[model samples]
Target: MNQNKRFCLALDLKDDPALIKKYKEYHWSGQAWPEITDSIKSAGISDMQIYCTGNRLFMIMEVDETFDPKKKAEMDVNNPKVQEWERLMDQFQIPLPWAEDGQKWVPMDKIFQLA
Candidate 1:
């Protein structure tokens, strides 16, 4: 069995209960669009999960050696289905005030791990 590398990221949803509920609906209950999951797998992501508290979301992603953020980003740039999904998701997502311009899902640093 191969052990995949893990990465964490975070983003925030608009501070509205209704929109946040819809956001959770799309993500929870296995309702995510097929194209979105396909794109993620094609990008070398072996597994992904998202957790939310209040309006903030945390994501854990596990990927194989072939995973390259730059490459995945370039691929997403040209994928119409991914683009459409992103546009729809944008309605419920809000950039963290400290996020870089137009950036979503900012990478998080691991502070400590008990080994």
Candidate 2:
């Protein structure tokens, strides 16, 4: 594996199967909007992968040493295309019951890692 830092996050898909299918479709390689990919790259995110099972979704992000979540969040706020993509995605996503207000992807605690 690469030396980049990895963060894992979890969220839920709206319990509707159809919406979940559409969400998967939107994530297909060529289906994602170019602006969305560009924004992520510009934010210093080296790589990102999302997986789904039932109604649960997991995201694994690999970020470079220069990546700052706070800075990325601020940049995303000022990017209109990023906002539009987020709004579209919100239709298929739901925060976990324990998630704080305004939180979407809840960070996961890493319990163990082998050296």
Q: Model 1: per-residue lDDT, tens digit, 2-79?
A: 869999999999999999999999998569999899999999999999999999999999999999999999999999
> Best by lDDT, which number?
2
- Tens-place lDDT per residue, model 2, 17-110, is 9999999999998799999999999998999999999999999999998899999999999999999999999999999999999999999999
Range of the 10 consecutive residues with the lowest summed lDDT in candidate 2: 1-10
- Each candidate structure's TM-score, on Cα atoms with residue i matched to residue i, is 0.95, 0.95
Most TM-score-accurate candidate: 1
| Candidate 1 residue pairs in backbone clash | none
lDDT of each: 0.95, 0.95
